[model samples]
Target: MIYLAARAITTVFLLVGAAMADRTGEGGATIGSLSMRWDGQWYWVVATAGYPADLPLDATGHVTQNAWAFMPLYPVVARALSFLLGGQYPIAAIVVSLIAGYVACLALYHLLHARIDRVAALWAVALFAAGPLAALFQMGYAESLFLMWLFLALLALVRRRFGWLYLLIPLMGFTRPGVLAFALLLALYGIVRWRHRASDPLPARQIVHIVALGLLAVVVGFSWQWIAGIVTGDAGAYMKTELSWRRSWIGDDGGFVPFDGFVQASAIWFRVWGLPEPLGYVALALLVVAGAALLLFEPHVRRLGVEVRLWCASYALYLLLVFFPQSSIFRLLLPLAPLYGALALPRHPAWRWSMLGVGLALQWWWIDQMLVLGTTFTQIP
Candidate 1:
């Protein structure tokens, strides 16, 4: 445990620290103070300055595309932590992002070590710590914190403490509506498991509990939308705004068009974004195929219990909803962090080499462009 903890902290410090400094600034903590690429800068700014609700966006308003506003949970956390940290939101945001990232790694170490071989577990986690997605963990975004919540919930499920999963799943719903699927999936899993073991008399308590959870997902997933609608009264507006965050998935004819349209749009997500051409898409396609393969072939997976399925399923569902086979190849596949240790970690030398090579090359490239230089500020006006 001690060695795992040390390796976990050391890996994050080396990887995330360097990349954050590169993207935010050479000044280490100063990089995330300004918005860089996507949702990060806005989270940090709103945390410190407070939420801005006006149109066309005020200096303080973190702009949205259509319906995709900043999910409130992380920024709200940023705000509270910023207040606690003497009003230094930048430092606060950095602190939260870094701490959450390490905590997630530590949890990964603990969770994976139990399932995978010791050495493979260590390397698997190290793979995640230094993987391409590690860059996102450093930004003032919720991915790391969101991941922590996810792993914790699934870890509880593994222990067969259904109560914990029930509680935690709703919290995930509050953070990202996408997470609501976890609750729904768990209910489906519960239903299927019960039906398969027909003679094993269903546990009344568990059935009621699981159904209650499914209901909760319905509320929490849309509560944010309900609130937003009451305030803005623009049903499609918010949905349109959210599309900007996922244009890679917005589709060719502006929706989930039929076969031809989907093929064209998916082609754009891959070709225009260089997702598949870069080999990343190949990895994602492989993972998706692997998941489909699981549902098709694995019969005992359900009997092995909900923890194994739910944790793995949550990430698989996340990928499917986003559905951009190219960009997601493996770069943003960090949600698989828990699975790093769950499988028999890269046993074959050939497999290990491929995984390591792809992981390292892609990770290095992500960091190279993520950093920001501050020289423009000091130049003569």
Candidate 2:
């Protein structure tokens, strides 16, 4: 409890400090104001008012932004909490995220300790707590809620508690689109255990149960789109709304392409450097693929356990394929808890401390840019 409190309190201070700086420089703003500034604003609107019945469209008939693109679980909880708190959605959402962040750290620490030594586990928690974009913990974003549930789900998986999946998996899907990685990880884990049946301790019947649960988890993970589609009376409502986030930025009316972010980034770099654009794209593609392969197959990563390895691999691939390489990608990757395991590996004391120092520095840097200087539309937290 003390450890968890420390992590939570420290995160709160970092965020508050950054908010103070923003207020001082931007003619004053409350911490609550800072909390609901960006995506939190969207959640606040959705929670209080609910999503529109139609996919919002611009004058040009292009799909405009809609809250339906965001997941429902966080907003639903925030709405309930706000009702109890006299209808203060921002405060309610921040409160939910703050509490969830602390609990997530606690569960994450225990999860890591189950696989590594206490010292290493502690180090992993430190790294995560002070990581770049860690300030997201204090925001009204769903990251904390989603991560807490995700860590608890992972803990349940490590303990072979299939019952938790029924609740946790669905909540995860309702929290973030990234839940697909968890669904895939569970399926892959079942497959691995089946292939190594002699080494697997679970009974054959339990194996079947696990596989069945994994399939259900996948269905639940993807159920939100269908749910949204039904509500909006448009089968493609979810996709159209989500694609609106990038359609104008990438100018890609073409269908989804694998590694689309890489292609856009490569073109941007080429414009800056005067290099052949395709050459840049090819180079970035090779580097990303190589780096992913290294992390997936690295001995240190493998030691994090088969399930963690698979989750990291699937989540990393999902990011590469779907997400653009923007500042927000750092925040999006925070749920990849297995990366902490790899970071916790035994290393020189100086090396470990140095990495911690660098992480702290970057955390503050991110807080300043995304929270303090970002009160305007200059940066996305």
Candidate 3:
């Protein structure tokens, strides 16, 4: 236990130390995020003041609320920290993000310790601490907030904390839409477990608990949509926006989108280099070729084990569903870095570590590029 604690503390310190070391311009000067990147500017404005409905809209004529701009949790935490720190909102924002990033590392340690072996868990936490995702956490954006909540939700899940899961699930939606999948999965799991185990050796109260858990997860999972509807005066409006955003980019009339379906659409997503002509079909064929190579033997990655395969497969699908290319897919996949390590086949521990080495190099490139994060897409400007 002491060893685990010590390892976790050291890993957290490393992540925080690295983050603190990078919180500024050259010459060790502390630079506020106000003029840094796109999301950084949005968050800086939010810290100075709450979002107003009359903020300037983009050329698309969207209502331009900070609601669609940044997630709420980090900004809320930053506001409190700013108030207490003599109104230095920028410092407070950086401090909050670094602290949240550190906490997430600790949570990841525990999350791993619960499932995998202790050594593997420690290694996973260390890898994550120094991973490309770590760079995002160091920025003023809400990636740290999303990751911390995600780790917390996972920790709660591993402990079978159904009630806490219910609470966390709703907050997860408020964090980023990626979490809704987790909530829905949890809800379905509860239902399936209850339905299939009705004749098992559990008491009536246990059955009631299962039913309640399932119902809570379902309600909480969808709660964000309902709230957004009330806020926007239209049920599923936000959902439609999210879907429409994808539809416009990948729908039938979308130039690059092939008729093969979402899979084809996904294949074409990463190849758009702001080309005017439709390159979707061309992109789709290229992806099919690359994907087939990865599956076959070029990368030599194996498709064995459900946990191993699903991690990469599901993540690829998730990316396709979200379809973006501001940063490399490798950097965006940093949040789930631990899972990728889990998915590596042929047991090349050295190769995996080397890959992580590559990831750190990539992270540094992004940090230097200053294209840390945002929903608008990132490319350090």
Highest lDDT: which candidate? 2
Candidate 1 or 2, higher lDDT? 2
Worst 10-residue lDDT window for candidate 1 reads 372-381
Write down the lDDT of every candidate, Cα atoms only.
Answer: 0.57, 0.77, 0.54
lDDT of 3 at 228: 62
For candidate 2, the lDDT comes to 0.77
**TM-score ranking from best candidate downward:** 2, 1, 3
Q: Model 2 off-target regions past 4 Å?
A: 1-25, 269-276, 375-378
Residue 354 local lDDT, model 2: 81
Candidate that scores best on TM-score: 2
Clashing pairs in 2: none
Write down the TM-score of every candidate.
0.72, 0.90, 0.67
lDDT of 1 by residue, 247-354 (tens): 434432363322332234454556656566445445556856888667446643433244556646765675566443433244345565665553325467677657
Per-residue lDDT tens digits of candidate 3, residues 181-221? 45344444455456667563445665565466546655655
